[model samples]
Target: MKLPPIGSYISTSFIDWPGHVVAVIFTKGCNWRCPFCHNGPLALGVAEELDVGAILDDIERRAAFLDGVVVSGGEPTIHGSLPSLLRRIKGAGLAVKLDTNGSNPSAIGELLNEGLIDAVAMDIKGPWYKYERLTGKAVDVESVKRSVELLKSSSIDVEFRTTYVPHLMDEEDLRMVRRQVEPGRWVIQLVDTRLALDPALVGTASPERARVAEAFPDVPIRG
Candidate 1:
């Protein structure tokens, strides 16, 4: 099976996949444009093309040393060859983790049902009302809800994360997000304004972890 076109690859990363050493593959092209996105190049589909055979060969060589492979985006689910890519990775005796925006529930469902992904990290921008404002695009909030439900019911390790942009989201918005996806792991990620997609947010300060924790006493905050 032919692998999807890759935007970039990290030979080794400890933080991408929790408790595991893995190679990270960044896929090109995103469905939504978030002002706070740090990977504007990838999101805009301006990434360099990589050779799939070489990537697989490298993975095969490092399989003995690596625990898994993380497929992140530009929204990995947007690629049609993602399943094939995951299959190849699994065939190499490595596990697969996918990072998505939860905009494509059908793709996520197919991967989960087929047992192609071992873990998932889905990003929930904010409450339904703020999605369009945060993403800078029209969003299908229903699809995001469906995706959340699917992951919550799945047996795999799933985590829903929201990047807390102080200007775009407030304490009440965070609370609303927590309520919408109750009884699951929710992580609050602090935004890095240096590389924000929107120039206006270039110097915006991120919310302090302690302050966010105080605001969201029930939810977990990640720096």
Candidate 2:
């Protein structure tokens, strides 16, 4: 099977999956254009292809050490051949976690149905009203909602993440997002505007992690 177009990879990560070591794969291409996304290059399809086969081989050799592999993006589900890529990781006896912008519920379902993915990290771009503004695309908010429900319905360990881009949204918007993603783990990521897709957003203020944590209480804030 042909590999997914891999943009870049992290050989190991401790913070990505929390309490587990995993290699992170950043796939090429994304449907949305979040100005605050750190992965702007990968998302905009401006990355050079990596030797995916070699990366997989390395992961295989190091499988005994790594707890899993995280297939992050650019939006992994956008690729039709994603299942085959995950299948390879599973074959090497490694657990797999997928990161997505939550726009493709069907693809998520297909992977879960096949037992290809062990966990999921889906982003909640913003409150319904500001979806298009935050995503910088014509978003089908319903599809994102469907993906949220699909993840919640499954036994999969799911973490719904939201980056608080103060310029695009406020605390009230975050509250609305918090309300939508409750009864599950939700993380509020402080925007790293320096790496934003839009350089214009550099130095855009994001709330302190402690302040955000106090606001959301029990929910974790990441930056």
Candidate 3:
């Protein structure tokens, strides 16, 4: 099986997933063009590339210290070989966490049903119309909607999040997102404008974190 092209790996993370020491696998390629994306190099496949073997070797060395692995992206679900990749990680005896855009629900479902991923973090990148605008793609919002429904009903631990980019987001947008997500584990992330995909987007400011959390009174907010 072809290994997913790896961009980088983090030997340890405390916040990538709550309560787990995770080894993060950064995969190359993405289908979106969110202006505020911090990992633009990964999204554009313009970063310094590394051998997948080296990444796995590093993971193997850290496996004894880590309790889990997080397969993050450049949208991980876009890669066709991710199931096999997840299987290999699970075989290492570490639990798996997948972070996705919810654009490819089937792939997420397949991994979940196959018992490969133990936790999921789906980025609900604003409302459907705004999603197409921000992502720079003709997206079927229903695919995301379906994914949300599946995650809500699935047995695995799931969290929905939105990266708060002030230039592209507002109170109304957050309201719409909250309605769609209901009362699950939701996170409102403050954008790190300094690392945005486009340099022009660097100076934009988001609402105070406390205010953003107050906007969704029923959901939990984390930094």
Candidate 4:
């Protein structure tokens, strides 16, 4: 069976999954090109590949200590083999969390319908109007909307997040996102410019967590 392209792996992470330790598997390649994206290599498809068998071996050994596996990207849903890979992880008796850009609602729905993933964290990069601008690519706004609605109504746990880039995003933009994903958890993440895809965005200061929290009093601000 063909395996999902595994670009990199993190043995352990406390923050990727709330209240649970997880091993993060980074998939290669992404459809969008958000300027502030820190995982440039993964997005550009330049990251080194790992043998799927080796990765599974490691996961099996660490299963006793791990709560789950986080299938992050470069946009994990882009891979057609993602479902198969997720099934293997689930077969190991570990929970699965998927991090996506919300560009592929069909894939998200398939995974949810098949009971493959336990949680999902999707990036809501501002409002629909600013999607292309922020993502630096022509995007299908409708597809994104579909993904948002799917997660909101699904049985799985979901969190919609936006990287708070000073000039690229603001309180108004986040408010627009909130309106679309109402009654759903919206998290505002502080941008980390240390290794941005767009070199010019490096070193740009992000808004303070408290300041953003004050701006969107009902939302959660994370760094």
Please give, for residues 1-223, the per-residue lDDT of candidate 2 as tens digits: 7879999999999988988899999999999998888988899999999999999999999999999999999999999999989999999899999999999999998998999988999999889899988988999999999999999999988999998888888889988998898877888888878888888898888677777777788777777
- Model 1 Cα shift for residue 6 (angstroms): 1.0
Instruction: Let me know the TM-score candidate 4 reaches against the reference structure.
Output: 0.97
TM-score of each: 0.96, 0.97, 0.94, 0.97
lDDT of 3 by residue, 11-90 (tens): 78998888999989999989988888889889998777778777777787778899999999898999999988887888
RMSD of each: 1.1, 1.0, 1.5, 1.1
Give the Cα error of residue 220 in candidate 1, in Å: 3.1
Q: After superposition, how far is residue 103 of candidate 1 from its true place, in Å?
A: 0.7
Whichever of 2 and 3 has more lDDT, that candidate is 2
Error of 3 at 78 (Å): 1.0
- Give candidate 2's error at residue 206 in angstroms: 2.3
Whole-model lDDT, model 2: 0.90
Model 2 stretches astray by more than 4 angstroms: none
lDDT of 3 at 220: 64
**Residue-wise C-alpha lDDT for candidate 1, range 133-157, written one tens digit per residue:** 9999988889999999999999999
